[model samples]
Target chain A: MSATFSAQDPRALAEAPPMLSLRGVTKSFGAVEVLRDVDLDVRYGRVTALVGDNGAGKSTVIKAIAGIYTFDGGDYRFEGEPVNVTNPKQANAMGIEVVYQDLALCDNLDIVDNLFLGREITSNGLLDDETMEKRARETLASLSVRTVSSVRQKVASLSGGQRQTVAIARSVLWNSKLVILDEPTAALGVAQTEQVLKLVRQLADNGLAVILISHNMNDVLAVADDIAVLYLGRLATQIDAKSVSHAEIVQLITSGRLDVDSARATTTISTGERSGSESTDQGAI
Target chain B: MSTVTGRDLPGLADAPDKRATTALSDYLAKVRGGDVGALPAVLGLIVLALVFTGLRSDTFPTTFNFANLINQGAGVIVIAMGLVFVLLLGEIDLSAGFTAGTAGAVLGVAVTNHGMPWWIGVIVCLASGALIGLVIGLLVARLGIPSFVVTLALFLALQGVLLQIIGEGGQISISNPTLLAVMNSNLALWQGWVLYVLVVVGFGAVSYRRMAKRRAKGLHAERFSVWGFKFCTLVVLLGIVTFLLSRERSVNVEATSIMGVPMVVPVLILLLVGLTILLNRTAFGRHVYAVGGNAEAARRAGINVANIRLICFIICSTMAAVAGILIGSRDNGVTPNTGGNQTLLYAVGAAVIGGTSLFGGKGRPVDAIVGGLVVAIIANGMALLNQPAGVVYVVTGLVLLVAASVDALSRRRAAATGRF
Candidate 1:
């Protein structure tokens, strides 16, 4: 695939405000390039949907952002300042939390424990159970997640949806300003998908920037504020959710090339005006 | 794996505003959570006692026999207490036997040879054990060697050292008056019984108060009936033990005031209690579980996994050393072969039988005590029956098998139930 990016125009886009941004991100596994010149942005209170075909670098982008992997040629910026995230702990320290697909929960531990995990609050050299359980319950309640009866219930006893909620809640619980979710609704039933989508939207509405990596187009459409489509190793386009339709995004996902003629034809500039537009577009065609 | 039933966690979320509970309530919550695993063991003890009583009739119920049982069981119980922590992390400490032997030899050198104060020698013994633990921890964590290998090496090396220390002699007899006094002398029978009662009651009371605090703070309690039942059972058991030890000297026996029970019993009990609290209540304890449960996960969570493992090995080795010293003190001497043969086997067996999973992350110091008692009882009972040492070994092996098999089966069932 050709590098369709206009190099000069990227400087202007680079100046745009970003809550979290990756510039010139490049990743390679041996000789295969997974992510090449990938530039992405997430704005505060906005859900940026990262959609791509399998192996289209969605995971690479998310992992780099979450500090699961270090990209070779990228400047990662949080709040428009450059930062190097060497590990997940570093990412967490910088207010970046990643909720992976498996959720990484201890089945034997209760909701409060899973939420706190490694960051348990203790006093007098002992686990402060009361304070932890209290904070856990309050956090869940604040998130409006009422499906579960209590925070002390073990995560193993929860349904898939409730587990997802716990996972997401845990990532966003402690001073998090950015949350990255990978395949949040991949295995969920209809009701569960609805619950998780609501949570994603809720997270963004709560003033946190959310980077949602999903393969489900419909789910993305339901929760995303701005949809960024990645084709091959490069980001093809990012369109306002209000301006794009599911079918148009799907075309961008499958073919990488936009059907400009069809998009223009549907906009109703008139048949005679369309003919006039084709005359100007003839040189490029 | 038992499936996690929602019913198992009843009222976890229903408790409204538990954080507002008093300090007493908070303490209660912790005690309640810690004691959840002890009920089954307690029940097993009662049933076993009743069954043995029924089967042996005259022999099992004899007062002399009961005292003998406590005396013989005390040493093993101490060893098991230390082994429990090692097992809790799903690790084993094979060196405990040799570690104990080494400590015993050191005590011999300190008291008999150097004429050090018994107290100073005791301190040195414990310090030596802690140092062994530290070495084992470093080997396992920093050197990236497995604990089994590290401990096994220590076990062999320590055994050799103990033999050399004994200098071809089979035993190092203790002649220190103070040391002998501790091992052989006892308070008035009634006084000893009273002291035991007070200690047991004190702990039970602390446990009760802690549980009550947790309940007040809106944390889950192990059913109100369960806590009451546990408390009542403990009281009854303590009463029986104290009563048994308080029995009058045999009618024909000369000293009507058969001095108080051996000091080993209380020391063993205290060690078990202290270790249990340390394993379950402290941040270090939690880190141990985290590392055992999943080292990678623990590391990702910002825990220093290597450091936790290192510390655990150190603790385990140190405990082993303490156990050795206790054994030597109880016997009033140290021997070249004191900790060889079945010592490691029994330590591991006691730990396994006590219900600490070989898989780690789910066990307690109490389990080790129970398991050690079980082993000691078997040994004492066999000796009473005039069974040979070989027979005792076979029986112990079978008992260990049974314990391990039962644990495996129960865990498998728990997993199936999704209660993991």
Candidate 2:
């Protein structure tokens, strides 16, 4: 696996114009603050892995990114300009697609219908189902998901892995600029997991920035170029995968203890960058 | 002993390539309790006919008795057609009986007491019924009240209004000669039978052609053999009914001059066919089913569920009003008791027994007519047997329960097995 480095200054890296960037993102549910002053950068043609343990606020961060839950404070910038993602539709309109864990598909509907659901193509005020089905076939083929025989088949008839493939293909079909996949291989068989990981790598190689959230350390190591660990709603450390060992990442994720060398590595990479002076040690559980 | 394609073949008569055919045959075999409710209703009618024939011997099979069945079934058929639309949306209209009565009473006053034209009065009455239906629908949809509660209130309120409209006079007789002549007119024997045949043929052709077109487009098409069989059977069955009615004593009294079937039978038949198409083929119809099947899912799919529901209520109420005018015209007048309490029961019972699911998402106007005939046959048979009206109620209730139980069981099985 190849690792990515931001090169001595995270703020300077931001000045280089990321494909998408989040700055000063904070979220709270009622009285409980979940995400505290978090910042991240996603550049074109790179797979950025967001890894954390359970209750590390990874889901809340992704949900915030997906517009499932709004943030209390944040600056979301796309292509060097600030943008506001107030809802799923707004996020979609801005070319940011989130393929969540559930996929939110209607099983009774066929693949073409599910792919174009809520915004089906219409001609003369009636559904242009023929054109939609043709486009759906092309989209799946573009993703190299060849297991399906007919796009007209109902989703209920599909296997679990095929369903996931269809969902990923749906997001990509819309020309998304950034794709956030939540636990893409969480419930898959070994072979299916391999298929999804391959698809994820291919997605980044296709020039779109990818944000992969997974608890599987090995899978993340296999595909991610950069890894950001969050411990108890705070960013513990962000490091290049090639520079950090699996044991160091586990420690940083679970204990918030950046071993001497790994801490130096973070300082060396983000050297003159403004460090978020928040208490990462508060979540040292 | 029968092992041609396999070693110890177990009922595998055809090759593996014939699986689609086998599946279709299995579906057809389950038609009585299949996804379509029409099968069981048809079966119930046959069983009821046999039981009645057995009980009354010659009287039940007589031409006069059969004509009486048609006469009694016509009003109920019209009202039940209206109920099917309401029930298809998983809603209920309890005020149909009273709505019919109120509309009839108002029309009666306009035509008889105020000397207004019959046609104008009927239009006003239907509009009134439609307005009431809209109000009830709005209350149910907007206020989030249950449909049963909303309609029940309408039922009680309309009953009071109907009584007040009729006043202490108790009855209002129509003196409109043109209206009476047109509504009471029947076709001559041969002409009546011809009209029924033409209607059944016309309706069957339209249905089959549309279904075939849908099938060709890779959409669902009912089994061709089943569709053909149903259409042919209906034509023959209607022909027999017309023949029976033509042999009645009234025909001989008119010196065989009026050889056709009653005008109301064709009218009811046309209305049932029209409503069935309106509910099945339109986008609005699909939205209604979606709303009833799963409201949240329908909303997420961007359907205007509330608007669909409101339109359904208006259709149901307007249909009831139409039925009311027809019934009043047939009886030559309207009274405070024109649409009695039994009318509501008969209308709802017809819809339920005909295969309209009380749970919604499944129903047809044609099923309502079949259910209406079932109720009418029971009443006619009981009267012929000199049995009490109470017996008719018991039998009808038992049939309704059977139909509802069958529907519930079928739905549960469909959910479990994931068939159509």
Candidate 3:
């Protein structure tokens, strides 16, 4: 990365600048240091997967980025400009949106209402239902999400995958530059998972940076262009998805250590037994 | 970035309500699926009206009784309408009855003893109700006290305040002609017709424009024929009421002519329209539903849930103030028991009977009116049958129980079907 910018505004920097970059971020709860010196980079039009074991500070990293919990120490930068977002509203203003695991959707409301819960379109102090309904449908269509019948259907009647679609669609509804999805496909079925992963890919394809946090290795490897692994509140490695094997990721996740020789040896055995049909779109790469 | 799939899955059951026979069948499907809405209340109202008419044909079916029913039920209906807000948040205000009583007492003391004008007394009364609601809201929203406990405490405390306002065993006769005119007066025949015309035209225009807008967008909107039917029904219902009310209903037309629609009808109608619009077409209303449905989700969505709860409580109490004034107007005096005894229960009964779910996140101002009529018709019919107040209470309680059962049962059915 260059040290100097040609443009006056850091936000107007050249094409190579990261959409968001965090360096040496640390957080503590009382005497316990939950996260220590974590560095991560998210780029425009790419899906960066953040993977870690339970209690390895995956949520902490996300919370810090989402501005749910302020990091004790960090250089939190967005578009090369140092930022100190103290609340979720500020993060949203900086074009950062997080789709939590719970989706935070009201079951009693319809898809359109849920999508624009707090931010309703109004004219003359009255709800502009037609305008909101039109935009909601367009947003869904843009994501190629046709799993639900109508935008007016209540969320309570929607399937798990459809709910996830609505939740993801809600995040992208605003002009967000970065979206952090926590376990997007954690509770979906086989067919639904494929639909969601493609959606994740489509998000990046649409020029929005996406950070996907998941425990599923297949999902991580299948949808992520770059994988940033965290171990024990610290950065284990940030590597290209193509450069790492399944066993290598497993090793990094478990021990927070790298053994290139052993990883290369297990690749042959792992690839031989893995189903080729399951990886058709992935296999082309 | 990697293995991409979707937009090609044949497994999705994504069928829009775009199929043939969907208009009728879809309604049937929803009804079967436990979303019966206000049908039960309407049917209950119809059945009760018929039974009461059959029991006391000469007295019950008369136009005078019809007008009487409207006046008698207006107070409870308005109170119930206010309760709808608190009820929408899945909260209750048992103190609503006493809140009305307290407001009535305040109005009485202000106008009678203090020589305040009727409007000033009204403003003071409404303010007191709002203040009482604020206290309840603070305990429930800010302090996290359960609404039932806080309102229950207020219910007992407000009665003492009521007794103190009018004094123990003291009753203040409200001789302010303007205030008394609210329940005892009637609009002239021309005025009634004019009001009816305004209502029907206003309703038709709004509905037609909304439908036109939706249709213009190529979105799902009711068919013209369907809209026509609904519009025609409204016209017929209002026309019949106005036509009937315009006739002379006085027992002795020589001395007094008590014809035309009661003044209370127009007031109730105005309240109904305003509150309906407030609940359905406003951001604040949506937030109330959202918070009621899932407070955690609403909180995450950046909605101030506590504020919504606090406001709803205030609305409920303010409504209680209006109902109290109606009661005082009807009785021509303010008494300690103006909003005491079965007043709150009847209002709650009327709300539930109108199909406002006690479980929350469902109801309308119209529901209160419908439920109020049901309660009023029963009382009126039973009184014509020479039934004691005790018997009337028992019967109303039973009907309320039936309405509640329908609500709970329909919810279960809806859940089972919603899961499908």
| Best-matching candidate per TM-score | 3
DockQ of each: 0.24, 0.11, 0.27
| Residue B261 error, candidate 1, Å | 4.0
lDDT at residue B343 of model 2 (Cα atoms): 91
For model 1, the stretches where C-alpha displacement exceeds 4 angstroms are A1-17, A27-34, A68-75, A187-191, A261-285, B1-44, B54-56, B181-183, B187-201, B215-229, B249-252
lDDT tens readout by residue for model 2, B1-420:
011121222221222222346557756755532455577778888988999889988778766666557767777788888888888778899998888888887778888889888788878888988998889889988887999999898888888888898888877777687656535766677777688768887969877875666455443346676677778888888778777667644536655443347677777767866676566544465566666665665565557778888888889888888878877877888887777768988888888888788877677788888899888887887787887878877877887788788788877765554422
- The number of the candidate with the highest lDDT is 3
lDDT of 2 by residue, A121-218 (tens): 76565556555655676566555565676676656557667778777877877778788999988889988888888878767766667899999988
* Per-candidate fnat, comma-separated: 0.30, 0.03, 0.39
List clash counts for every candidate, in order: 31, 7, 0
Which candidate model has the greater DockQ, 1 or 2? Answer: 1
Please give the ranking of all candidate structures by DockQ, highest first, separated by commas: 3, 1, 2
Q: What is the TM-score of chain B alone in each candidate?
A: 0.86, 0.87, 0.94
**Docking quality class, candidate 3:** acceptable
How much is the lDDT of residue A274 in candidate 1? 21
Report, for every candidate in turn, its global Cα lDDT versus the true structure: 0.72, 0.73, 0.85
What TM-score would you give candidate 1 relative to the actual structure? Answer: 0.84
lDDT of 1 by residue, B1-420 (tens): 012222334323565333324434744543343323444445555665676676677687677667666666665666667776677667778888888888878888888889998888888887888888888878877898877888888888988888888886678877777666554555577777777778767877877776777677656544555566677887787877777667663545675545356666666667766776776676677767766666665676678977887677667767766676666766889988777778878878877787777887777787877777777777766666668999988988987897777677766766654444
